[model samples]
Target chain A: MKHLDFWFEFASTYSYPAAMRIEKLAAERGVKVRWHAFLLGPIFKAQGWRDSPFNLFPAKGNYMWHDMQRVCQRYNLPFVKPSRFPLNGLQAARIACWYQDAKWLSAFVKAVFQANFVKDLNIADPAVLEQILNDLQLDAEAILTQAQSVESKARLQAANQQAVRLGIFGAPFFIAGQEPFWGQDQLELALDWCLHSEANLSSFG
Target chain B: MKHLDFWFEFASTYSYPAAMRIEKLAAERGVKVRWHAFLLGPIFKAQGWRDSPFNLFPAKGNYMWHDMQRVCQRYNLPFVKPSRFPLNGLQAARIACWYQDAKWLSAFVKAVFQANFVKDLNIADPAVLEQILNDLQLDAEAILTQAQSVESKARLQAANQQAVRLGIFGAPFFIAGQEPFWGQDQLELALDWCLHSEANLSSFG
Candidate 1:
């Protein structure tokens, strides 16, 4: 069976769309997904981009907001532009890092995506994340404390390093057998490639 | 009676995909398209980008190539990567400036796109453009001469100035009244907005 590794950031608006759709789409294609949550803030700072490129250019930012609305409409998803343009995704990523189980990872991703895009909550706020945990019936304080553990922090750092090594400079990146696909719109194609690439391998063999 | 203006650059790869699809889609939705050919090279230079941002960043360029392959496959369009990207579009834009009729503009754009992406021909070559003109049953020499006229150059320049004023930084941009939509992928949304905006205006009034 084919598998896709979905690398996403909680603060990423585009990632919200992909997260909302990837699982259902993958199931239809008979492909399994591995959700990998990572922080893009550190990566952006490393690249000297002070903010999301979309925000840096006002026209691009304006267009992106409208574009997201249309895309959300097409997907039949609610889209409320987040109050904070680039929320601190570090805590969410840390939680994701601590919870590596597939089910927990997906739930966390959905919760975070919904919190940012649908609820218009500041994902960086610990209170918002605590509420997310409380709603999920998980131990809010325990998870928040776990997210602050040195091991979890190191794991996030490792994820950021891995993203850089893989040449990712943006959010919503996917890796399938070393091939990287960037952007939410590229999700379907990435899955298709992962599913279809075996034929090329067989031919080469 | 709703019409949307499509601003495109001859050298943009994604624009070819949108250009090939827009007319049919617009017809389906009972909307009209007004094609506006403009140069992005001057615009990028004005923004201090030497080449397409995709090319400037290797990772982005790589992902974009993969993404284009997928988009083309989905559309079932022949998409051989062009050897000369960011092809000198000055002559093409000048010629388009001279020809406002939809028939000539559509055929010329199709020919240019085919030349670059399908045949891998150097679009900057006069001989290649002459061949395209001849194939269209157009007088190659006369068109070429006219495309080079001082008035034609000024017209192209004026179009670029208009793009600057309109806050265009990329190709395949659409304008529906005061709203702007960027990228080939957003063509449908732009068309939809054009069709529905009148209802919005009436409701507001």
Candidate 2:
């Protein structure tokens, strides 16, 4: 079976559309999508950014908001600019990293993006994450406890290290074999690379 | 005829593909393209960037080169990493701006991009611009003289100011009606918007 690794940061606005649709798109291409939730905060800080580049560069941010509106409208994905730019996703990311193999993981990822980008809710709030987990029929309290544990926190740190090693500067990022594709718009191009490049299919190997 | 404004910096990598293909694409869609040659230097400076973001960020620079290869391959356009990245496009831009309404403008724009991104030539060289102009059967010396005049310089400066006012932070940006689409990837989307959008087709109005 062909496989591709998808790296997404929860607070990323473009990741909203990419997460909402990637599974079906990948499945259609006979590709198994590996969901890896990661943090952009560390990567961004390393780049000397004190805030989201969008906030720091007002013009890019202005164009992005307008562009995202069009992107969501085109895809029928509901979008509302979050009340706060780049709400913290540390808690959400820990859960995702810890439960990476859980059957409901993808749903949880999508729901969290929706909560932030669609519902304009602060995803950093425990109650918000708990509500999202409960809505997915998962044990909210238990998962929250585990996600907040030192162990889960370490796993997330490791994931960020791995992402940095992979040279991912943004999300949604994808790795098809040894190739890296960035941006939500590159999602199909990445998958197509996975399907067509018979020479390189051992994603993240 | 329906119309769209194309904003391109001669040194922009993605603009290579966008410049090579936009005319045919727009013509096919019954849309007229208004090519606006502009500088990204002022825009970047305003954003506090001392260099191209691609250069300022190493990881992104690495990803961009790889992605450019794939993009070029997918489009069947020639690709070559210039000996110098982001070669000064100032001289070429001045010519492009001064001659924006000339019949041979589009051909000249494509030639300049081909020179910089494909043939690995310094587009900033007057000899290179002269050669491209000579190839177009235009009087190279006369055009070069006019392009270097104070009036031409002011036009280029004005063009950059206009792009800034329009919220254009990157190239190749497109304006279909009042909509601003950034990057070469958005060219088609911009054209489609021009064809479909009825309420705001006055363009720069």
Candidate 3:
């Protein structure tokens, strides 16, 4: 079976839409999606940005807010502009790393995205993450505790390193075989590559 | 008829695609396209960039080249990487400004894009601009000379000022009423807005 890797940053607004819909879309194309939760903070810092570009450039921020509203409306997805520019996703990402290969990873991702984009909830708070885990019937305290482990922290770091190595500059990025597709809008294009490209199927190798 | 403003930078890679295809696409939608030839240099300078972001970030530049190849292949259009990074489009833009109200503006725009991206020619050369004009059955020397006049220079400047006032930060930016859509990818989205948006159709007013 062919697979596409989805690299996402929880703080990324566009990733919210990709997260909400990628699985169903990929499944329709007979492709499996490998969800990889990563951080954009380190990447931005490397680019000498102290904050999200949306905040760094006011006009861009205004345009993005308006664009996001339009996009969400088109997709019929619930969207409320978060009061905060970029919600800290460190805790959520760590927890995602801890449950990286778990069956409920996608559900956890959707819930976290909903918390940040739909509910406008601060995802950085431990209590918020714990509540989400409880809602999923997972052991909240145990998972939260493990997510804070030294090894768990290192795993998240490794993921970021992998993303940087792959030349990923933004979130909601995809790798189908050797081809990298950036942006939520390219989700379908990536899926098409996964379903069709025969020569580069060994790219993941 | 509803209208969409297509703000393009002659040196913009993405604008090449939008310029080549917008007229036919807009015609199909019964939407009128207002081609606005503008310079992105002032906007980039305002953002404190001395070069294209593609040059500022190597990884992004690499990805963009690959992306452009894929896009061209998908569209079945001729693609040749230009010899120069961002060809001096100042002359081409000024020429475009002089022909701004001409019926052949779209054809000239497409021809210029093909020359730069397809043939990898130096669009800044007066000889090249003259050749393109002559091919279109226009008086090459006369138009080229007129394009260099003081009034024509001011016309280009005023167009750039209008783009800045419209919050256009990049090439191939589109404005359908008040909704600004940035990037070549948003061309269809902008057209769709032009066809369906009634309330915001008076945005330009």
Candidate 4:
């Protein structure tokens, strides 16, 4: 079976819907998914945007909120406009990166996304993250400790660098071989491409 | 029984694909389409972007071109990257705005898009505009002359103000009632909304 790399940023509004559904879609098609948690902060800083483009452009921001509501409605994803527009994703991402091979990775990631997007909790808060891990029946104490270790931090930094090298400007981005598909709207296209790609898993990043 | 207002800019890259298929799509859904040819130059200027955002942001530009390829491939629409990134859409928009209710509006709109995104022609030139009109078997000289009338100019200007009031910051935007959907990816959502909106054609703009 072919596979695709799913690059997601925890605080990315669109990535929330994508993260919740990617695995099921991939499973249905018998394709594999590699979840890569990376930061958009470094990438946006490189682009000279001090804030999310949504916040930077008021009109776009206004439209985005409404679009999100419509999208959530269409997908039947429960949504509550977070009191905080973009709560920091660093802690959640670090945990996700450190647990890249964890069997519970997708569940943890989805829980964090739901906490922030559906429940209006700040994902940057360690207490919130701890609760998420506790609910997942994982060793929260050990995982949190491991997530803060030098090796874990280095791994996350490496993922950020790889995201930059892959020319990812936003999330959730997908890679099938060397081809990239950006935005939640392209999820199916990316999955279908992954299954059909001649290069398949060999050339996927 | 229902209708939508399609906000398009001739220079917009994504709008090229939307323009070509909107009529067909709307027709299939038994929805009426109001082609609102408006200028993005003014809207973009207000947002402090002097050039197309594609030129301002290279990564987005790079991704957009490839995405266009993938989208066109999926839609079976022919596409060729124009040598001029965003050829001036002012003249073409003026013609479209003036002929908003003409029997040949959709044909003329699609032809102009084809000229820019398929044939790679400079749509800004009057000769190119005249040739498109001629090919449509219409009175090229008369329509071209009428397109420049003061009333025609003001009508297009009014559309620009209306688009701004509508908070449209992007092309391939659709309005069903008061609901706004941006990007070609949202085309079906907009059309569906138009069809199902309780207000139906009454509240459509």
Highest DockQ against the true fold, candidate: 2
Q: Name the regions of candidate 1 deviating beyond 4 angstroms.
A: A28-30, A42-48, A175-181, A188-205, B27-30, B165-167, B176-180, B188-205
Ranking by TM-score: 2, 3, 4, 1
**Across all candidates, what is each one's fraction of true contacts kept?**
0.25, 0.71, 0.33, 0.50
- DockQ of candidate 4 against the true complex: 0.46
Preferred candidate (lDDT higher): 2 or 4: 2
In candidate 3, position A197 carries an lDDT of 74
Q: Provide a comma-separated list of chain B TM-scores, one per candidate.
A: 0.94, 0.96, 0.95, 0.95
Tens digit of lDDT per residue, candidate 3, span B1-205? Answer: 8899898888899999988878889999999998889998888888777899888877788888888887787777888989897888888898788787899888888899999999999999888888898899988888888888999899999999988788778888999888899888889989998977875443231
**DockQ ranking of the models:** 2, 4, 3, 1
Q: CA shift at A156, candidate 1, in angstroms?
A: 1.8
Q: Give every collision pair in model 2.
A: none
Q: What are the per-residue Cα lDDT tens digits for candidate 2 across B1-205?
A: 8899999999899999999989889989999999999998888988788889899999998888877887798789999999998899998899999999999999999999999989999998999999999999999999999988999999999999899888888889998878888888888888988988886443332
Report the number of the highest-lDDT candidate: 2
| lDDT ranking of the models | 2, 4, 3, 1
* Tens-place lDDT digits, model 4, residues B1-205: 7889999999998998899889889999999999999999898898788999888878788888888887897799999989998899888899999999999998999999999999999998999999999999999999989888998899999999999898899998999888888899889879988867874333222
What's the count of clashing pairs in each model shown? 0, 0, 0, 0
Candidate 1, B162-192: lDDT as tens digits: 8878878788898877678787777887888
lDDT (C-alpha) at residue B74 in model 2: 73
Candidate 1 overall lDDT versus native:
0.81
Q: Comparing candidate 1 with candidate 2, which one achieves the higher TM-score?
A: 2
